[model samples]
Target chain A: MTTDTIVTAAMLAIGDELLSGRTKDKNIGHLADLLTISGIDLKEVRIVADDEEAIVAALNGLRGQYDYVFTSGGIGPTHDDITADAVSRAFGVECIHDPDAMTLLGDMYARRNMDFTEARRRMARMPNGSTHIPNAVSTAPGFVIGNVHVMAGVPQVFQAMLEAVLPTLKTGATVLSRSVQSPFGEGDIGGPLGDVQKAHPQTSIGSYPKFDGTSFSTELVIRARDETILAAAEADVRAMLEGIAASRRT
Target chain B: MTTDTIVTAAMLAIGDELLSGRTKDKNIGHLADLLTISGIDLKEVRIVADDEEAIVAALNGLRGQYDYVFTSGGIGPTHDDITADAVSRAFGVECIHDPDAMTLLGDMYARRNMDFTEARRRMARMPNGSTHIPNAVSTAPGFVIGNVHVMAGVPQVFQAMLEAVLPTLKTGATVLSRSVQSPFGEGDIGGPLGDVQKAHPQTSIGSYPKFDGTSFSTELVIRARDETILAAAEADVRAMLEGIAASRRT
Candidate 1:
């Protein structure tokens, strides 16, 4: 298998508040950034609810398709937190409080002489035969069962934990990116952009035309591994957009 | 069922750039806002890549579990723009360019004298037997195959499309929301919050602690349908938060 072929990952962002507009789920973006730097292809990203069936289905689908699966949220202290149970159900593994997770959590609270109640200790539960992904920022540790890495929903904590675990992951080829932005709609750029793409079949050029109330702007993106090819592709995109912009001006 | 029975919905955010952190998706928040007003419980939100398999799997998972599904992204002129096709595949329909969609689309371009190329024409190709979701901002449209509503990934366009279509949606009794922010970490509020939650079993309270650089604050949200019960829960949350904030002052 080639570097491009080896590793592909999926993100599962799980939360109810995220869907309610109460909170923006930032964990997926963070994981995406971290995973990409480590050369893991973030092939899929999913934001699912706290529901058992939905989470189970997503976990199964992603695990079956990709090399690694990273799930964030529904692993908190609330009643809505159901990731552990659902993951256990998905893998058919026993969902029990792992000793290592409990010890870490206990030490965290014991250092301050705080009560680690049943609810707080709920964070210690892990799918059987899985390793705990340490929580550096918080005591609640995420765990790995099969290919799925269960993580925190909180942004800072999620990033820190992912950084810790990413080093151990098998990586794919690092995806390279370059872009060109212009004050025009995508339609104006499509025809020429398509021609450029037809030439550089290896590179993926994306035209993102944004329309605000005032005016429209198009951000053309060229993504690939080869620097020379990416640069060549980007030059063509710039030329196409410039030609369109020049024509529109006239 | 009862007004107490929850009405659930899922958000499907489809984009590869979002997974790269190259773009932070804001449509989930917009969808959440719109769904909240309609008494539709935004149960889950998912972000997928530009790949067709990812989109199709997400659609199946969300559509199977939730009462309704709203998908955003992959509905543009680019080659990776495949949300409509994936939805078609998910519903097992022949992904065809419908005649009605073509008529509306033709009329849209006829007014402007713009040549509708294959890429532009692709926008009009929705699932067979799907309903057209009119785009107020752009002539390029979204469609509804079953209960799932396909919308644009752009925030403004997504919100506009949702507003246009939501009125016709089958919504339930309005969900009431009340929140109180405390200058404390979630851990600090966890104990008392647990007690309050136990006492008010009818209401579901969500705690989100935000760290703004130097200090931390938690927003405690209480949501339910019954007006009197919602008010009572709000008062309790306010009292608890005020107690914490007042104690901090001393």
Candidate 2:
């Protein structure tokens, strides 16, 4: 859905594996970065158990509230796979064995010289009327129903599907950023840094402090819609850091 | 916060560093697991820019919707940090230097025999009338206000603070789970799998398919409050996989 203003999107990552710490979610961050660059506001994110109600609830909450809803996980041939069914329930569609998806599965398996078992065929199940979103790195494809974009949870597959899907997404004005780093500790730099931020009200400047055991470093990042304002803030931050470092040395 | 039925929580991860990919967010998954195990349902999570409005908007949303709100990050002695101010605004409370937090921070720095900068002293700020949540990790303690529990974003500190704060919460029945793995792809099992699920209404069965270069390996997880029901569902899953694999071998 194309929007003149910011397009908000929600993310639903489903799996017990993630909560069990067996898997760290890489897809959300990738989407956050990708959507940020594309100018889509990622408004809300939820991670739920593989329970059908949980999936459906998350889907219902996300679907129409934002321009797009992205769901990852539970679209596989194994027993825990329930996302397609949940989506079917959420959208009130039949969990049909789509012929198009089946053909793709059949072609891929035949090319690989493998027997297409019923378990293998499960990958073709989609909510009726949903369009397939191709996976560049894997054979099993992702799909879209209404605003909910359902994809695999596997990092490689998720990323490939994201690349495939992003090109077609109706985007917004991109959020751009720049940064300046300092060797000084944030404690010695916070107030002056706050002043720098207060002075540049249009451009948002954020301070991040890091410790490397023996020494400290802080990064001041300036972000805005306007490139010129962002650049000006970056220079101001650099000047502050240099002045502080020089004063500290003396 | 104690409720007879349930305690819901939301996680707020603040850091421009995380958004920039300079630092990986390690606390989100940890907090999710800990809350799940404690029988506290983690309903929502947010990662925000270090801007005050962003933090305030997220804080207000979680505080209003959930039984308890847990925030991590931006409570440190740094200029980029503004969660305390944001939270104060959300709560409509004056954020004067909190006496107890000040005492703890001062003592911690005094023990190290180091000079505490104005930024270091900034860690003393807390919303008016909040209760101090003990920090056994580094001693720059967190605080609790109403249903909101503000903790450090560092994994170790955040975890330690969560453990300390969890006892103050009212818990619900613990969630239990079990898993079964199969060699066949998901398609071979969908039809019968749906039937088996229809038979066992109490047990929630989740199917996850893994794309293993040449073949698909799927894992069926059966979850329920009743172990007997879960085991029965597991037995049915085993039989389903056997039927699929046998057919594949032919």
lDDT of 2 by residue, B1-250 (tens): 1345566777788876665454577888888778777777776666776778878877886688888888889898766677889889998999879987777778777898866778788888889998998987667778898999999876777888988998988877555677787675566666678788888987667666677766666676676656777788888878877887787689
Tens digit of lDDT per residue, candidate 1, span A1-250? 3555558888888876877777877787777777777778787776766779989987887799889999888776655677999999999988998888888888888997877877677778778898888876776888887788988887877887887888888877777888787666666566677789899987877767688775557787888877888999988888877787688689
lDDT of 1 by residue, B124-238 (tens): 8888998888887886778888989998888778877887888888788877888877676666667677778877878878877575655446777888888888888888877
Worst-scoring 10-residue span by lDDT in model 2 chain A: A207-216
Q: Report the lDDT of model 1 for residue B159.
A: 79
The residue-level lDDT of candidate 2 at A94 comes to 98
Query: What does the lDDT read for residue B235 in candidate 1?
Result: 84
Model 1 residue A77 CA deviation in Å: 3.8
